[model samples]
Target: MSPVEPSTAKGAATRARLLDVAARVFAEKGYGAAKFSELISESGLTKGAFYFYFPSKAALARAVIDDQERRWVAEVQQRVLAQATPTQQLADVMPAMLELLAREPGAWSVVRLVRELGADAGLADDVVKPMDAWIALVAGIIRDGQQAREFRADLDADGLATVLVGAFDGIKGLVDSTSPEDREQRLTRYTGILGDMAFAELGILAHPRDL
Candidate 1:
């Protein structure tokens, strides 16, 4: 069953608190390892109160995933794209996402939880939908760039978008495994390289400053 939506302000606060606590708990300890008691304790909510909002741990996990996707699309994807040219928007994608993940514990937790669940849990598709949206957004930008002669007309925007998304995801995985201090530097270098590769493929002359 779906989670209960609280109508009152206090109820809404309580629900949000539960989600925040659950996200941290699940992220720290994988969904299977995370206990209901830990979530309740961290949330500072009683068991009865917790059950009022979330029927089960699985339900809470799903809620966290859904919320993460919404925030990512609204706050990250749409927000960044709104103020930049298509090429600049594409260039900003990875850096913006990496920054968001670094700053937002809940966002980072959602990514960790989704990775832990993998494809066997039947949650992969849901978790990956936001990424699919990102791909579409990037494709649109690439198409715009092509029309403006900022990118190569011979290249397929959709195909290049897929490759870029795959490259970012792969690099992110590697960066996530490194020390926190090194992650930013590693990501910056890796993404810069990817951007250079994209620019080269598109026959665009990238300024050294662009990297």
Candidate 2:
């Protein structure tokens, strides 16, 4: 987790500014290339101001991931939850996230950071595992559906959720090497195939949603 968030308004604004600059920098140059000197200069904050919120690059990186994850859980997941049935709610996960990615630059950085930092970083205790949180969320939704007789009773909700989340995240990586136009086509194809197969097998739907 990040150091305690600022309790003061001015401190909060400064921290947010740093995050905005850092997110872009990290996105352009992966974590290994990002430096505090560049981040502080880009944010127009003094060294002391930057250190006040983040003691190291690793800390700031964790904050970035946590911030983006919180937004997805709040903005994307909550919007999907508004759907009438658990089936609809589960089905909306991919499209809802795609919408966020379309507008949020920070989200793309989080994806790169998750793959990079998780590979090394060696700060397992400090870094928040957003993937784990996602799995728990999906599994909870699956359990609710199962209990309501809306999802298959024979399937293990946790395992099923793990597979869905794993495939969903991995499928996004498949687009990184494609041309911008082809990226959307491939994502839609992969996501639709995954969602359709999973939804049908779970008895959620026989046909795809508008996604």
Candidate 3:
């Protein structure tokens, strides 16, 4: 059976409340460690109300991951990429994601939840994978950069976009493994290293920190 969608203002508010509290809790405590009771208590929703909106922990986790990742992606394009030129936008992408992660608990929650709820989790179909939006954004950036002669015209934009996005996501995990004090600097350095090696042949490379 399909879960009922919120039809009234109060119902919508209740659902939003649950997602907000759930994202924070899941970010602070991994999905396995987060308690359902605490989610209900912190959200100020009764057990009955919680289940009305979300049928199970898996259901709620799916909603939270999808919702938060969509918001994160929109914010990246609207807020982070809005000011930069196409070449600059390409450089800013990974470092800006780390900067957002530092301030946004919701982004971290998506990261944890995405890892926890992979294809075997039974709800993967519902997720708006962050990588898809990022790859599209990078592809657009490459196209524009190529038009401006900022990126090489010899390469296919979408192909280069896929490679760079994969590289960025992988490097991000590496940055996360370092000590807290070293993480940000490492992110900038790693992104720079990626730019140096990857973009040097193809574009006018700028370290993300420099941009």
Backbone clash count for every predicted candidate, in the order shown: 0, 0, 0
TM-score of 1: 0.83
Q: Candidate 1: what lDDT? A: 0.75
Error of 1 at 140 (Å): 1.9
Q: Write the per-residue lDDT of candidate 1 for residues 140-195, one digit (tens) a residue.
A: 88898888878888888888899998788777666665566766678878888887
RMSD to the native, candidate 1? 2.6
* Cα-based lDDT at residue 184, candidate 3: 64
Candidate 3 Cα errors over 4 Å, as ranges = 1-4, 119-121, 125-128, 174-185
Tell me how candidate 2 scores on lDDT. Answer: 0.79
Question: Which 10-residue window of candidate 3 scores lowest in summed lDDT?
Answer: 119-128
lDDT of each: 0.75, 0.79, 0.74
| Candidate 1 weakest ten by summed lDDT | 202-211
- 10 Cα displacement, candidate 1 (Å): 3.8
Write model 3 residue lDDT over 11-50, tens digit each, in one string.
Answer: 8887877888899998777578888788878877778877
Clashing pairs in 1: none
- Indicate whether candidate 1 or candidate 2 has the larger lDDT: 2
Error of 2 at 209 (Å): 2.0
Q: Pick the candidate with the highest lDDT.
A: 2
